[model samples]
Target: MASPTLTLHQYQTAASETDRTRTTKPTRFLLLGLFGEAGTLLDEVKKKQRDSGSYVGYEANVVEELGDVLWYLAVIASRMKLALSAIARPPEQSISSYATADNEIRFSDLQQQAHLPFAAPTSNFEITLLRLVAAIGALANAQQQSLPEGDEWGPYLREIFHILIQTANEAGVTLENAANENLTKIFDRWPEERHFPPLFDEASDIAEEKLPRHLEVEIYERTVARGPGIEKLYVLQRCSGILIGDRVTDNIMEPDDYRFHDVFHYSYAAVLGWSPVLRALFRLKRKSTPKIDEGEDGARAILIEEGVSTFIFAYAKQLNFFEGQHEGDLSFTLLKRVREFVSGYEPKHCPLWLWEKAILDGYAAFRFLQRHRKGRLILDLNNRSLSIKAI
Candidate 1:
């Protein structure tokens, strides 16, 4: 595979190209307008229902009004140049370099054959947050891409249903599973009420225990040249921002200003199986990330530094259930070192709901174009209808 030749300088140039990227403001304003109206309308409807006390008449209206709010979210995402694909993440090489030396980038970090699945579509504010986080976290975990899996916030929901189904199957949870089964519930709350139940648990034991794919992350070390506290979060945040890129216009954190609060928090919870991970992770003192005072220089500097890996790296990978399928993606040296781990367990049937789980959590269909020779997995929604693609 031909490796993509991306440099920190390339990212700098992209961000500094004030003339190249279009301002998303006009569409953003339009989304805000829609959001305002949809919110007011929903509030009025909700109020009426509350007053009536036995409100069951306009259920369809409630759904339609909620749909309107999601439409605005789509518009805002479009304005921001964000991919409406539910799960979003940074690139692979970036994640590979950061992770412990035992990982590879895979589709949203799943071991896969990019048969995009559907997750139980969710529109609730919290579920939306979960869907987005799952995408980004999977990316952070492996720095890979997948098929569009869904749409610009409309039918895009179908993809989540596909995912939810898969997640439930993997966790050995029933389709009627409640919030008690952490990973399974992520998929079960579909086909009926799409609203995500409150989180079952802070950590996903199923993911860590059952889907423990080995990672062969390339370790790169750097001496802290600036404030460690600020630099740590800044680098993490910058990784997410530029990785997320022009997609997601509503976020004002400008990539660099964003933090890995959610990513680190979630991972630590899952990995350590403890709450202390969150407290310990953020114990680093905070400092203000400096603004590039020299015209566009600062922004350029951050973009270059932060975006450098996304363009050049590969994160996600697909796993095969049996031996003899390493396909040379594994380096002989690393494989030799970890063959003990590989030999430790026989590959088992991964449940369908667990990505292995067979449930409708999100769209299972996607166009994950893997150019292994190039170390880049280009993603496309195949919006052949919309001609929309995310590279």
Candidate 2:
């Protein structure tokens, strides 16, 4: 069966649902974001030009950037009380001769119609992209001079719609595909409502395979002598008064207190309800099912979890361990890279917000342990929170 038809009207309506900006000047905010995303698209192309063959992932990046541009266009048109389906098809005659302002075209009808004249490529990818950006700039300039809910706005809007289609064609991207991907990413990052996903082991009948919903762990440090004149600082973690993981040292020439990094796994468990490393350490592997045991909670999954913890730690270290930063402050690049790290793993099911919470809260706990040298790391999965208390 064919995938259900998607129209510009439907896409515009869906995109509006994800708008988080509540500024009094929404037009300015939307236009500014439009320009910034366009510039980012250009920058990505610039890198492709500078790096040539080494610049892989250009197509994927273009799809994402173009999808963002489409979102802005849709929202801007809606903001101006214009139907995206109507704006999508520029009038063949002068703007004054076009249908009345109240007249709206059904987007479903647009799906039945053949590709518009603008869909034909007028220039190369670079030239077409430049024209599209220039068209947006022209629209923004026009918006400042006159109120958008008037006849003066129609032509500029139509021109932008025209050039945008051509630009996508020149880049060999399907507009519907772009819109679909945009919705997928938007919902993944910011859903209609926030709710904790069910715990990973919620369905397991075996108690040993289930992660503790409430866990209080003790993390402290001690100095031990390996040689006559040398002593090393080590961090140890325990739970329920029993030693859990082995003691760890920084294992680096510099003392960054990385031995306390287990806080990251704790946070992941608490916030995301998924952490293969912890499952392995706590002997909670779901061994009743071979696939769940060897694949989901297995060695490879554990490695991926450890890799994500270390990767995020390296990123946080450069930004003062994300100190004083709140949600949405972490760079999308960092989060996207992390998503890539666990692309095939079970943890990838968690949303970006959960990952952000895990990282920020984990670093907060890590910083606390670093300062006090010992603390209780608390994991409350029911509450979806992690916190530290100094000992």
Q: Please estimate how well model 2 matches the true structure, expressed as its whole-model Cα lDDT.
A: 0.78
TM-score of each: 0.19, 0.83
Consecutive 10-residue window with the lowest summed lDDT within model 1: 357-366
lDDT of 1 by residue, 74-105 (tens): 34444334433322232222221111222122
Kindly list the per-residue Cα lDDT of model 2 for residues 287-350, writing each as its tens digit. Answer: 8999888988888888888889888877777989888999867787788889889988777888
| Leading candidate by TM-score | 2
Candidate 1 Cα errors over 4 Å, as ranges = 1-25, 41-45, 53-56, 86-391
Alpha-carbon shift of residue 118 in model 2 (angstroms): 18
Over 4 Å off, model 2: 1-10, 24-29, 39-59, 78-83, 93-123, 140-153
Error of 2 at 149 (Å): 7.9
Model 1 clashing-pair count: 89
